[model samples]
Target: MMMKQLLLSFSALLVFLHFTTILAQAPAKSPAQAPAAQAPVLPQAQAPALTQAQSPASSGPANVTAILEKAGKFSTLILLLKNTQVGEQINSQISNTYKGLTLFAPTDAAFSNLKSSTLNSLSDKQTLQLIQFHVLPTCISLSQFQAVSNPLHTVAGSSEQFPLNVTASSSNQVSISTGLVNATVTDNLYTDSQLAVYEVDKVLLPLQVFGPKSTAPAPTAPATPKQAPPTTITPVVTSSAMGLIRHAALSFGVAAIAAFSL
Candidate 1:
């Protein structure tokens, strides 16, 4: 009975050892773990758009008629420019060359102040010259008139014939004298590097066409001397007449006696 019991205990002990060996060989369960951290997402960069000022449209040549029309109060001057086709010439010059231009714009009121027949009296050629007289070949500013020499040249002709003299006062008051008319600069209508338009109070009448007339004096007549009156001779003849009458009567008496004796 003792031997059988020993055998049973030995068998049970061996079984317990085998089970422990199996548990040691197997992998152990790990604690719960968080997911792998991912890199932060970043937004893609984009290109900036261009602004209006950064990309401007190409501009066209300056137009004198359009400028005067926008300013107002220059109707008569504008009409003259169009009629003479000077405005188109100005635009063409500005577009084709780097040369600048200056215009002296007379207001409608200024035209009204002129005589009724003033514009009508001018021929087509004379009207053209008149309009050209107001424009300078080069642009000049209000302040520049002070330093400019007298009798500035115009598009009309030479300075000797179409002289345009500009004078500026201490108060910056500018005046233009063309010998025939002295016009004041009332306002600055427009000014740019290419062109300048000044509002004048009167028309710029050039000396070539509007000079004064010369009158010659009349000749004097010569003087004449006075004549003497006729003299009277009645008293002087009285003594001679009485002597002759007595002599005639004595001769007659003698002749009568002689005849009676015969």
Candidate 2:
């Protein structure tokens, strides 16, 4: 009876030991445990967009007509420019052909001050020449005029002597002298890489259009030479007076001596 009881106890203890080993081999999980942390989700990167300023810019200069219109004082000038073929040439020069151009624009008051028939009677060709006289084929700024020579070549292309003369004073005042008219720069209207517009108080009259100012100066120059001849005659007049005085004195002496002797 004692041997059988010992065998039963030993069998029960081995069975319990086997279950404990199996439990240790397997991973343990609890209801309160958290899941493994996943990598943080990140937003996808996008390409950067170009801004307005970064876009390509216009390569050409502004239209000459548009620029003149904005000035608000060149009504007559703008009208004349648009109507004439010379305007085409000037626009071409300002935008493409030439490096730039200098425009001497007369104000409305200046245009109004002209003789009643002055602008009214111009032939088409003459009108073209008149406008050409106002434009310089090359670009020139107010400061640059100080270095340019008098009789600067104009777009007129008439005669070499027909160029405009620029005179800039130390006070920074600039005047343009055409052979017939002298116009001073009243204000600087506009200046840029391709064009320069200067406002003038008087209309620029070309010598080619109006005959050279009266030859009155030519007559005055001769008057100077005539006055020189009068200077030469003074000595002759003085000599004649001296000879008359001597003759009178000699006659008086002879008469007085005769009287005394008698």
Candidate 3:
């Protein structure tokens, strides 16, 4: 009985030792760690700088002649500018001396209205003066004319003799007067930093170039007729034959009575 008991105890001890060794070799179950947080990605703006650098700048003429050529109506004015050499001076002064320029341009029809002799009779110097009279040295807008001082000086250089009078009518029509010539702003052709061109109805003629003429006669009203005078009227009378015979008999009786009494 003793030996059987010993064998049973030894077997039980061996089983216990084997389970301890197996538990020691197994992996431990520690608390699980969360995955490392990823950084948030930011969006980038579009590249306008590269686009702007690649685009080409606009190229164009800044002179008055070039600007006028763009519009078709100023052909007549352009012709005159090229013919007179005033166009060169205008471009020079506007680019160098003056800050800006103002021009009163006439249309093809306006030039056609003039008599051939009017411009033909003028000498080259006179023609230049006439062209200069059309331009104001500085740029003047339509609104500026409304508030201008009387007798506005022109580029023509004769401030006293060739000055212009600017007036705005109640109807909103702006007109310029040079005594001999009166014209209105029919259209606005161009306005910019260096040039302003206004279309005018008539060609400007200065009194300095064209002398003064006689005044026009005033119109008269018709005369009325005179009334007739009043007159006194007389009635006509006829003598009767019986009344004449009675008067003769009475005269004979009176004569006989006078003889008897004698």
Candidate maximizing TM-score: 1
Tens digit per residue, CA lDDT, model 1, 1-262 = 9999999999999999999999999999999899999999999888576211121223876688987898888888888998999998888876665658988999999999989898898899989999999999887777778888988999999999788899987665899898889899987776766677888999988877767656687776766666676786556687788899988999999999999999
Q: Indicate the residue-level lDDT of 112 in model 3.
A: 87
State TM-scores per candidate: 0.59, 0.56, 0.56
For candidate 1, give the lDDT of residue 164.
Answer: 89
* Poorest 10 consecutive residues by lDDT, candidate 2: 49-58
Residue lDDT tens for model 3, 1-262: 9999999999999999999999999999989999999988888878564311111232632566775686676787787788998898887877665558888888778888999898889899888898899988888766667777888788887568787888876554789888878898887777655667887889988888886666888878677677676675754333566788889999999999999998
Of the candidates numbered 1 and 3, which has the greater lDDT value? Answer: 1
Expressed as tens digits, the lDDT of each residue in 1-262 for candidate 2 is 8989899988999999999999999997867967899999999999587211121235766466766687787789888897886667766767775668888889888999999999888898778888888888787877777888767888777447476789886665898888778889987766776777788999998877776446544444434333433344334687889999999999999999999999
* Count of clashing residue pairs in every prediction: 0, 0, 0
Maximum-lDDT candidate: 1
lDDT of 1 at 216: 81
lDDT of each: 0.84, 0.78, 0.78
The TM-score ranking, best first, is 1, 2, 3
* Model 3 ranges off by over 4 Å: 1-61, 169-172, 213-262
Off by over 4 Å in 2: 1-59, 158-161, 212-262
